[model samples]
Target: MPTLLDIEAEARGCVRCPLSEGRTQVVFGVGNPNADLMFVGEAPGQQEDLKGEPFVGRAGKLLDQLVMEEMGLTRDSFYVGNVLKCRPPGNRDPKPEEIESCRPYLEKQIELIDPNVIVTLGNFATKLLLNTTQGITKVRGQTYPYGKATLVPTFHPSAALQGGGGDVISKMRADLVRAKKVLATC
Candidate 1:
């Protein structure tokens, strides 16, 4: 089996879709490859694309704070990545075709990392992993079992930035607590 680094190297040179043509860099993932907990987000934002890393933007800052203060975990303890390595043009939602093209790479990352608990941030990540079209409001904070992993759907940190308010933050915090508890058992 190819190691994560090998997969990342391949991803870096990927030209499978139009996204690769315009991207500054492919945001493969970051943090511990052997992490027991993994966070899957929708896709790379401008900052992530520029930095060639996932979740280093404003929302990432909030996420980092939550992981550090709320869960008592740091970035080093978890793997953070996106469903699509390349940024969608104008930061729009990724097209289904784009996702279809890139899904296997994300799947391979999951296989390699083999995280015990997977946190799906926002609607896109949650929908893709769960194979459902359910809204985040309906599914957030719920846990679903996927093979050997426990998957949790939660609000995207960006949702909070989009006027989701204190209620959303509270729910996310509760979900983080659940994730931390699951981590302890894993």
Candidate 2:
């Protein structure tokens, strides 16, 4: 099987989607390749696109804090990735075509890491993984079986920082704890 590095290297040259055309570089997934836990976000934002890493912005800082507190682990202990490897211009929601084009890459990441639990950090990741149109508000804090792993949904850290306040943060914390519990069983 191709390794994660091999997948990432190939993904860097991908032109399957228009988002790739304007991107500085592919923000391929990062963190432990064999991690028991994985975080999947919607898409790379400006900071992630520029830095070629997922969750390295202000929202990422918040996620880092919560992951440490709730899971007793650092971000490096788990895998982090996005639905779309390339940034959508202006940070808009990824269009359906964009998502379709990038699905294979995300699937490859999941196949490679084989994480025991996947914590989706927003509507896009949650909806895609769950194969449902339900919003994160409706699905956050619940767990569902996905392939060989359990999937948990949570608000994006950006939501917490974007006036979602204590409630969203608390929910995200609860979801992280749930992910930790799922990993223990795995």
Which window of 10 residues has the lowest lDDT sum in candidate 1?
Answer: 138-147
TM-score of each: 0.97, 0.98
lDDT of each: 0.92, 0.92
Candidate 1 per-residue C-alpha lDDT over 40-121 given as tens digits, one digit per residue, 9 for 90 to 100: 9999999999998899999999999888877899999899999999999899999998898889899999999999999999
The per-candidate count of clashes, in order, stands at 0, 0
Per-residue lDDT of 13 in model 1: 89
List the candidate 1 regions with Cα displacement exceeding 4 Å.
none
Give the worst 10-residue stretch by lDDT in candidate 2: 177-186
- How far is 8's C-alpha from truth in model 2 (Å)? 0.9
- lDDT score, candidate 1: 0.92
lDDT agreement of model 2 with the native: 0.92
